[model samples]
Target: MTTITQTAPLGDRTVRRIGFGAMQLAGPGVFGPPEDPDAARAVLRRAVELGVDHIDTAQVYGPDVVNELIAEALHPYPDGLVLATKVGGARDERGEWVRASRPEQLRATVEQDLRTLRTERIGLVNLRRQVGGPEPDAVPLAEQLGALTDMRDEGKLGLIGLSTVSAGIVEAALEITPIAEVQNAYGIANRTDEPVVDLCREHGIAYVPYYPLGSAFTGGPRALAADPAIASVAAGHGVSASQIALAWLLAHYDRMLLIPGTSSVAHLEENLAVDGIGLDDEDMAALDRVAHLGAPSF
Candidate 1:
């Protein structure tokens, strides 16, 4: 099968713009192995078959569950597919998420990811900063970025990225090191990262928006699925609402990359089909109106 033309340059590496996020491959509670191992394997394999050349995962995602599945499912990984993973987070004994950005912990996590992914070096290692509380008092952002910078120099990492970060953090990171990509939570219902997306565009860096289908909003997935505006637009194009959401993102920014995660092969194929769903002027305006109906602060 011919590969899709969805790749964008991240420093020296080229990765598919519409990539796959492996978070959903984990089990219930998203803290352990998947319930259906064979099904998860089929999903990953189908993603590759559908022209997905970029796969995003994190050690915190299962704390190792998703990456291990990735290795098991795609050992001897195909050439030209970029496998991006993140560090700086772990899980507690009870499978709760924990932030650990200490230099040693960061180093150890990278080493663990390398081993789990069965690769000498990670194609992209996003330094996922902690959110949802008071600022961290551990190592400074510069120091953490410096550690990754050193790793990149040592050929242990091909590129570096930042996840769930702000413009100020991006500025600080750029001062100490080069950032190849930035991952943030953005979608039709969530505009908290719009400024961050603009910054990436201005700097020519890839802006990957996680939860591109409107996660964490008050209406939830069901609300998004039933949005009258989205449904109307989707009907006009004979595409799914999910595809309209993704296509709008692809048209919203040239530097934008999408990593919608799924555990079903059918859903994976449907998500990839977004690449071929084009938006017209009227549809774009309709989407924009609904996207800003209850937009959040950036």
Candidate 2:
């Protein structure tokens, strides 16, 4: 039902829908450097070579570790590449995630990203909120959003995005400033953010689903492709379960941009090749059934 084609609008440009997420580029637990620094840089290079022009990253990732790697790997970035990052959180000495959404904290994080990513202005900066108890941090979202708006007015960011927030929150945000994109925890195995996804589509905002193949890669749940239905479809196509999951997402929504991240070149190639897989009505139906099968969460 979406008119979007091979590429989708994100921040200031229309980039290939199949983009890369840089979380896994960090060390395990996303707390430090990767095992192979050169390999990590090579993955970034390979991703660009594979035509992935949009990359999603966050300062909280590796607590400044990932951004440094990204800068090291892709500084003097090529033309048309969009660098999207997230704020609103930070990491502790123990590597635990904690809210940093206080207005000043948010501002500080943006400054940090600006320096770490080696860019004057980021393409899109998402305010990642903890919709549930553990993190939202006692500050009114409007106040937090205001800080970002101040930066935008100063030309520090190209556009504002939201993540891990509810549809109601998004509606409230629209009353303040236009949101360019949204990164939510959603996939074939978990469609909990359908309302937010549809809302973004209705408003022409890009919705980027984080766990497209399930948290299998990120250590959350059994892989979405492990579902018998998805596995069967992948088997039939002589492709991977991961490919089946990504293809269904592309077919199901018009503006859903994918950021399937991987540390290995082979996996990166597999994730990029998803567009070539064709899914029929039967295949789509089978994949849709997995959403209600008690999928796990982050």
Candidate 3:
């Protein structure tokens, strides 16, 4: 197997490029606890075994589900593994996601994430802002980032990030703190965050794309699997369509970090194997031409 060597500096910490997303470890409804606790643990263990050094999770995934699993499965974690978790969202009684970016809530979530991940300080914490929500305007970006900065000083966080943010929000964040990474949805099928990805690249910030594969709104499974161009490329390489999709993203950006989530070990292995799939210039050009077919809206 060809070992893909992609690295980026997170303020000062160096992390591997291909990361693991822990959201799928939760139950059917992401708001509730995981259906199979053992499966969650096994997935995490398998991630480390596969050489994934970066693990992404959020306090709202089960509002606590996935982080607890990480602690249980990999406490006393291997050296050089970066455990990143996010805050700023919570679940309501009906299992609906609610945005909570207030300073107090931010602080509370950080504390809980640290405790659940069994770490003195999280390697990274993404402050996920709700898109088209009323709250973003209410809380000044400075105040929100300042809270994270204070926590960093207190040794609760190593690096800070922003999710679902625009270029303007990213600029505002840099004024307060050194934005280490930016997580947004950017893939072959969804290019809404293209400008955001470009901005991160220019600023030397890692662009960690959440849904490098199509998300629920982006015509989900059938759309991705049945993509004619992707199928052709996969056939040429003797790999799965999902592998073709991920490889395209990895080759698209220099600082791109992938966090493809899956509950199945078979699927996880397929996703990781993307690093081994090579796409030359001709292959990339061909894929690029067909990439916009049925592209998802923001």
Question: Residue 149, candidate 3: how far off, in angstroms?
Answer: 0.1
Q: Predicted candidate 2: what Cα RMSD to the true structure?
A: 2.2
Query: Ten consecutive residues with minimal summed lDDT in candidate 1?
Result: 289-298
Could you give candidate 1's per-residue lDDT for residues 1-298 as a string of tens digits? 1122366777677766788888888877678888898899889988888778889998877878888889998989998888888877888888767787877788888989998899998999999886434465366897888788888888888899998788988988888778989988788867767889889888899888887776532334555678888889989989888888888888888767889878878878888888777787888788776744342221
TM-score of each: 0.92, 0.94, 0.93
TM-score result, candidate 3: 0.93
Greater-lDDT candidate between 2 and 3: 2
Task: Residues 1-298, candidate 3: write the lDDT tens digits.
Answer: 2234577676678876778888888886676777789988998999899888999998878878889989999999999888888777778878777777889889999999988888998999898876335455467788888889999999999899998888999998888889989988777766768899889888999888877777644555446668777778778999887788888888877678899888888888888878778887767776775545343332
Indicate which candidate wins on lDDT. Answer: 2
**Each model's backbone clash number:** 0, 0, 1
Q: What is the lDDT, from 0 to 100, of the residue 240 in candidate 3? A: 80
Show where candidate 2 strays beyond 4 Å.
Answer: 1-4, 131-137, 216-222, 291-298
Clashing pairs in 3: 60-63
